[model samples]
Target: MPSRFTDEREITGVADLTPVQRDQLRAAGKLYDGEDLDAAARLVDDPDDERSFLGFCNLWRVVDGSEDRYDAWLYQVDSGTIFRAGTTDVAAEIIQFGLETRDPAVRAELGPALVEAGLLPKSDVSYPEFAGLLRTQQGA
Candidate 1:
């Protein structure tokens, strides 16, 4: 079947994934309009089958063309679901909530794991101190 990720090579695909799964793929630039969702689903499920999750969730500042990418990646994604999804990545999607969101409440709620994961510096994990450039600059 044709690939949904790009105008590229063909591969066998899996179907019957959830709407959110499809949304995640779409947000990450894995699937496009009138493309193959099944093939896109295959990329996330198969860890050893040579897959690359494209697109940057952090580019919500500059790239405005992709509403799905912007909304789903930067805001709608949940970090707890990352491990449950096996290989699919929501880390890029949800980092803003934990480390860079302007809401101190959100950072307080989600920043701990980011800090423990080494995504945040030890110094920045403190309340007055902040983790990312966006976090410090925009959040403050």
Candidate 2:
């Protein structure tokens, strides 16, 4: 089972997108909106229920070519959180935690965009470091 964080997948960022890419992404999987995730999260009756988790993305990247590619939402397999009597805030927290938790591996793969979005540390470290490291530097 290949995950969205799959290392071998080819990626084309937003700038290079085309109509064909849109078609390919659609074919890959339905791009669940934030609202959709929110609704689904609310329906999470059991902590182990996986179907309640849906894929959501504001960012777009075309992976591989329509010729052959994997599901854009393979992240769903690695992501999602369950309700805790619905927890502190069912709608907001589920989506927040789920997205945050699943993103590290993928966010590191994001370079300028993650930096621009302020989700990553703006520093001299490369993308992998931005995603993987804890920055602690001192001036002596």
For 1-107, candidate 1 gives per-residue lDDT tens digits of 11011111122232543565555555444322234344364345444533323221211111112312111222123221121132344433243333445555444
Give the per-residue Cα lDDT of candidate 2 at 50.
52
- Write candidate 2's Cα lDDT for 1-140 as tens digits: 11111222323233343444333334233333333333324234555755343233222221322322222222243322211111221111112222332445443333322333343344334544543422211111
> What TM-score should be assigned to candidate 2?
0.21
Best-matching candidate per lDDT:
1
lDDT agreement with native, every candidate: 0.34, 0.30
Best by TM-score: 1
Alpha-carbon shift of residue 68 in model 1 (angstroms): 22
Clash numbers, per candidate: 0, 1
Clashing pairs in 1: none
